[model samples]
Target: MKKKYKERSARFRFWRNIAMFLPGVIVAFLIGFVGSDHPIEFQKLFDRDMLYIGSIILYLIIFGIASTYLFSSRQSYQMMEATEDEDEAYRYESQTRRIYDLATIFKGVMIVPYLLVIFFSCQKLIYEEKLTGILGKYTIPLTFLGLLLLTFGLEHQFRKTFKQIYGKAIPRNSSGAEVRELIMSMMDEAEKQICYEENFDIVFKLSNYVLPISLMAIFLVGITFQTDILLALVVVSLIYVYILVSQYKITKRYYKE
Candidate 1:
């Protein structure tokens, strides 16, 4: 049984490594395909020098994905198996909270450009100008680059925190496994209780539908009025503003002051 589980784990890791690199390769291929004047032209570009550049890019992407996987594996170990010490667990929890805050900040920061994309896309559709060029030429690539940099920084933070909490002496007892499972179950229940009491589930579910419906309405109005795209975008931004404000209040209520 143990051998079979280990084999399955190894297989999972093998597929995960390939899945990580595949997205980068697909994105690069799509960009080449879309930017090429003709299919033959794009095909010809993949010769000796270009193949070397592509190989280098592929290696760099694989290196990045491998780095992320290593850090994430360390983080998983810290969360699940390495939190035996009380002081280490406390520090890990504190770091986890800060990481959550960092994630919120990252999402909040990214929302600006996302809203801008909506406004600009609508603006271009309404006014029929050269705004799509800015989006296609700069926004997409820069956003992708930004996410890669952010991922690197986040992994570094996790690595630093994990190293600080990592202990050499792991206490093994007959009841340790059972106790760990009980503790994890209790923590999961507590998190679920908090979410239920806070009505987070309702808010998220509502937002899931409301955001898309609001955006769709805005787009429809833009198509109708032809000059009211900016106005519609303004209305949509206001909806997001309300959502953000409500989220701020909820966070303030739930989190430490």
Candidate 2:
């Protein structure tokens, strides 16, 4: 049990460490999409390159610390669930609650940057006559809001389920262990079926690689060939559909497995 917990905990920490910095990458990408002309003075104070690099670094630092605490709490919880040790369970619960509070403090780190993007988009549309930017601006906020609500709803459901199964009491009738085992069993099945590498074939690989390259090629072609806007859009749409179909096939195979 100890050996298993150590292995699992180590893997969890390593992956969670990687995940901790992912918000920085997403923030950078979103900011790239929200590119706008800055005032000369503002640009002089902090150029576009500096802005992106600084924001990415700040996000990484904040999110990395928060994720470390959250992951630690999670690891401790997982350990508590596996063993029947009362002292260990108490220690884990105490540590979890303390660090969980710390993690929540930095929860807005990702959201704030995204909100800034929407704000900038709106500013551009209103003052700069950027009608085309309206779609991306509104879409980002609406989509982000929907995803936030969905995440909260799913988390609430998981918490409710956990409380119902395990309750507040520690080591109650060994239910924690039983629940852990059940979770592990489900994970094993999922890793075999959904995560199976065989589901991805040559076509999938080629499509994944070629999709971006094709899009870039099409952009170049559109510029050089000077194709009609509608025709270029049609070609892009076709490529998008092909990529979407490829993803659907992978998903279909997962379900079949």
**Best candidate according to TM-score:** 2
Clashing pairs in 1: none
Residues 1-257 of candidate 1 have per-residue lDDT tens digits of: 11333445888979987886575557555655655443233234444334433443543454455445445445644684466887777776656544543443443344444444444434434554432444654654564465567555654654454344343222234277864554345456666676465676566765765665576566544443333468767777787678767887768889966
**Candidate 2, residue 6: how far the Cα is off, in Å:** 45
Q: Which stretches of candidate 1 lie over 4 Å from their true place?
A: 1-99, 102-147, 159-188, 203-220, 227-257
TM-scores vs. true structure, each candidate:
0.28, 0.33
Displacement of residue 202 (Cα, Å) in model 1 is 3.6
lDDT of 1 at 210: 69
What would the per-residue lDDT of candidate 2 be over residues 178-231, giving only the tens digit for each residue? 856654454556455643544455457656556545665555444433444467
- Which candidate number maximizes lDDT? 2
What's model 1's overall lDDT? Answer: 0.53
